[model samples]
Structures are given as structure tokens and as C-alpha cells.
Target chain A: AAGVIQSPRHLIKEKRETATLKCYPIPRHDTVYWYQQGPGQDPQFLISFYEKMQSDKGSIPDRFSAQQFSDYHSELNMSSLELGDSALYFCASSLDKGTGGTDTQYFGPGTRLTVL
Target chain B: AQSVTQLDSHVSVSEGTPVLLRCNYSSSYSPSLFWYVQHPNKGLQLLLKYTSAATLVKGINGFEAEFKKSETSFHLTKPSAHMSDAAEYFCVVTPPGYSSASKIIFGSGTRLSIRP
Candidate 1:
């Protein structure tokens, strides 16, 4: 079975640099969610999209922005990155009650972002 | 407001011993709950979920969770522990009024370590 795909499995950048992480949800999945996991921390919900539209927002910082493309892929763009931004970024996808009665998300191998 | 709590920060068990990871949730109404596991450098995997349906949810790899409304608990359990099951487990809760856009909240995560 196809799983979600994430780009730049590992990234290192200096403080104040900019970075972008991309996610490709599983085929036919209409909902995408982004999460961040700090060192030794649980993943935290950042934002989500449905049908190419921003559907929900969580504790995402103002310097961070994300969007889903027409092809159902999503991107998280970060600017003026801080050292605290270092973490594992994960992307998950699920069908919004389309077939499966439940919207259980499938996650991708996360992108590890390290801001120096 | 809704929140999910993982009672333990870490748990250790011997191989073939019973496994249990405690979770508690608070929600004004019936809530959607989930258990996700992540191995080192791996993505999150959905172990099981409770969506106002059956209380007993059987997931892949012999993992199961029971939703007890009276206790407001949804603990993941397995009859026996395996070295391969050593990982981080997260309890999640989706607040009421879920839509394609709602973001799921994750617990602080509990690290499960298995001894040979």
C-alpha cells in the first residue's frame, strides 16, 4: 500500500534562515494534517487542510504558513527560523469519511528540521 | 475544551509480559480518541481509534484499546510485550465539532521500553 511521502528527510539551517517541508498524502486521501515534535516531546498539531483549502489551525506560529496544492500535496514554509524550530515535522493523510467510516490518518516518515 | 493525558512518561516491561499504557481524556461530549505509535526515526502509526462505536478496538499487530466512558479512559493494551514494540505511544483526542478541518490533540507521549 502507498504511504505518505515527505521531502528532505533531514534539514539543517542557521537561525533566521528559511525552510520549507513538503508532504504528499496517500493517494485519494482528501485531508492532510501537519504536526511538529520537539526533542523528546509528543507531536503537536500545527495545521490541516481539506480539499486544497485551509481547514483548521492549531499552535502554528505566525512565522509559519502552510497550504495544500491542487494535487493534494502540502507544504509548510517557515521564515526567520529560530533554534526552537528544530523538531520532527510529520504529515498525515486520511479520507474524510469517504469510504472508511473513520478518518484514521496515515503518517509519513517525518522530516527532521534542525535550526542551528 | 478537550484534552488527552498519557499517565506515564516511560514504561518498562520484560519480553512476554503484559503491556499497558494508560490514557485519559476530558471532553464535554463524546469524543474521538486514538492511539498512535512511533518507532525510532519512524513515522506515527495508527494503532487504534474510538469513534463513538464499539468500545473494543482491535488494531494491527495484536494491539487493542478499550474505550470506557465511565472512566473517561482509552488505554492501549497487549497481552504480551515484544522487543519490536519498544517505542513511543501517544493518546489523541479530537474535540467536539469535528470536520474535515479539525486538528487532533496529542498526549505528551509515553516511551515503552522492552527488556530481553
Candidate 2:
């Protein structure tokens, strides 16, 4: 089975620049999620896209946004990046709504973004 | 609201020794619990999940977790520690009042260290 795929394993940008990350879900899977992991911390949920619609978002700032296309791919956009935004971004995909059942998530290799 | 707490920031175990990572969760409803592992420079990999099916859930790489409702704990265990198991482990819980599509809450994470 194909796992989730993320592009640009590493990225470096300056403050006020825009950063975009892409993700491709597993074949035939819906429900894609984006998370941010800082140094020595847990991954925080950024946003989720399900069935080509924005589903939910965690405690991300307004500079962050996401879009889903055709239910199989998604993009996370960070406008006007800040130093605090530097972190590893992870993309994950699940089969269904994941309603307290066996629907587990598969993750991508993650993209490390650095803001200077 | 839902939250997960990993009791230890780091755990060290010798090779062939048993390993245990403690996790506690707080949720208003029946919680969906999960354990994910992240190797160096890699993505998050799902080790196991609990969703009201079997209280004891078995995952890949000889890992398992038992969901103890009475203690609000879902601790991961391995009969023996392997060198490859040295990584970061995260305990996750889904939001209490929403469907699986809701955003997930992650623990601070526990780093597993294996000694030869």
C-alpha cells in the first residue's frame, strides 16, 4: 500500500516570506491531516481536510491555511512566516472519519522548515 | 476537551529488557487512544490504537497497549527492547465531544533510549 507523500524534505525561508508544503494521501484514502512538531515537543494538529473540505484545525495562528483538492491531495500554506513557525510539518491520512474505531493514520516523511 | 499526558520525558532500557511507556488521558466521552513512534528524521508511525474494541490492542514491531478505563491510562509495553526501538513515542487522544474528524491532542512525548 502506498503511504502518504510529502514534498521538499527540507526548506529554508526568511521572515515575512510565504511557505507552502504539499502532501499526497494514500491511494483511495480520504481525510488528510497536517501537524507541526517543534523541537522536543509533540506534534500539534494544524488542520485537517476531508472529502475536499476543510474539516478542523487546532491552535494554529491566522497566518496558516490549508486547501484540499479531489480528496487525495492537500496543501498547507503559511503566509508571513515567523521565527516561531520553524518546525517539522507532517502530513497524515486515514481511511474514513476515524470515529473511535480501527481507522489509524499513516504519516509521511515530514518536511522540516526553517525560518530565519 | 481531550488531552494526553506522557508520564516520562525519557525512558532508558537495556537490550532484551522489558519496556513500558506510561500515558494518561482526560476526555469527557469515550476516548480514542493511540501510540505513534517517530524515528530520527522520519515521520510519525502508528504503533497502535484503541477504540472500544479490545481493551488490549496489539501493534506492529512487537508493541502493544492496554487501555485501562478505570485509570484513564493507555500504556505501551514491549516484552523486550530492541535497538531499533529507540525513538520518540507520542500518546494521542482525539477530542472528546466530536467525531474522529475532530482535531487530535498529543502528549508532550517520551523519548525511548535503548542501551546495548
Candidate 3:
């Protein structure tokens, strides 16, 4: 089965720079969720979108924003990056993307972001 | 609110020994629980899920979990450990709801180490 796909498996950036991460969810999966896992820490929920609409928000920084496009793909935009932003970014997809969405989620290999 | 807690941060077992990983959860409503295993540099793979069905759920790779509502625990277990089983495991809980803001809560992961 096809799994979620993420671009820029690895990224490096200097302070104050910006970066964009993309996620292509599994086929027929309409909900996308983003998470961040810092070194020696568990994954933290960032945000999620259902059918191109922002559905939930977690501990995502104010400098970061995300949206799901018409293609059911999503992008996470981070501006003014800081060293603390370095971590593994993961994207997950699920079948349900509407009001009732308790479907199982499938994850993508994470993008390792290293900010200097 | 729904939350999960992993009982241990690390566990080590011999190749032919039994393996156990503990998890406890709290949810105001009926919850959807899941166990996911993640290898280094890989995405989280579904090990098993419990949705208020059978208390004993079997998964791939000879893994299984028993849900105990009285104890509020869902612990993962395997009869024997394999080298390939060394990885990080996460316990997750999603509260049942149709609200768009509902999200999954992840527990601090447990790192399993297999010794030959």
C-alpha cells in the first residue's frame, strides 16, 4: 500500500531563514496531521487539516502555518527559523476528514530539520 | 480530555524472552487506542488498535495487546523478542467525537532493546 510522502527528507537552514515542508497523503486519505519530535522527546502534535480546511491546532509555533490544498496534499510553512526548531517533522494521513474522524492514521517518513 | 502514558522509557529483553511494554490512558469518553512502532529514520507503523471491541487484539509480527478497562491499561506484549523488534513504541489515544478540534494524544515513547 502507498504511504504518505514528504519532501525534503533533510533540511538545513540558518537563523532567521524560512523553510517549507510538503506532505502528500495516502490515496483516498483526506485528513493530514503534522507533528514535531525533538531530540530525546516524544512527538508533539502541531496541526491538522481535514479536506483542505484547518481542523485542529496544537503546540505549533506562531511562526509556523499550514494548509491542505485541493489535491489533498498539504504544506507547512515556517518563517524566521530558530535553532530550537530543529527536530523531526512527521506527516500522517487518515481516511476520515469530516466532522466524525476517528479513522486510523498512516504516517510518512519524517523530515529532519536542522536549524543553525 | 484524553491522554496516554507510557510506563517505561526503555526496556531490554533477551532474544528468546518475553517482551512487555506498558501503557495507561485516561479519557472522558470511549477512546480509540493505538500502538505504533517506529524504527530509526522510519515512519510510525501501526502495531495494533483497540476501539472498544475485543479486549484482546492481535497484530502483525506476533504482537498482541490486552485492553483492561478496569485498570485503564493497554499493554503490548510478545512471546519472544527479535532483533528487528528493537525500536521506539508510542501509545496514542483519540477521544471519540465529531468536533473538528479533536486530536490524538501521544504518550512518551518506550524504546525497546533486544539483546542476542
Cα displacement (Å) at residue A39, model 3: 0.8
State candidate 2's DockQ: 0.59
Docking class of 2: medium
- Candidate 1 stretches with Cα past 4 Å from truth are A98-101, B100-103
Candidate 1: lDDT of B22? 100
What tens digits encode model 3's per-residue C-alpha lDDT throughout A23-51?
Answer: 99998888898999898787888999988
Interface RMSD for each candidate model?
A: 2.2, 2.6, 2.5
* Candidate no. 1 TM-score: 0.94
lDDT of each: 0.90, 0.88, 0.90
lDDT score at residue B85, model 3, on the 0-100 scale? 98
lDDT tens digits by residue: candidate 1, A16-91: 9999999999999988999898989888789999889888888899999999999999999999999999999999
Q: Whose DockQ is higher: candidate 2's or candidate 3's?
A: 3
Q: Please give, for residues B5-111, the per-residue lDDT of candidate 3 as tens digits.
A: 99999999999899999999998878888899999988899999998889999998999999999999999999999999999999988876443334678889999
**Model 2 agreement with the true structure over A1-116: per-residue lDDT tens digits:** 67899988999999999999999998877788898989887877788877888878776789988899975799998999999999999998877755432357789999999999
Residue pairs with clashing backbones, model 3: none
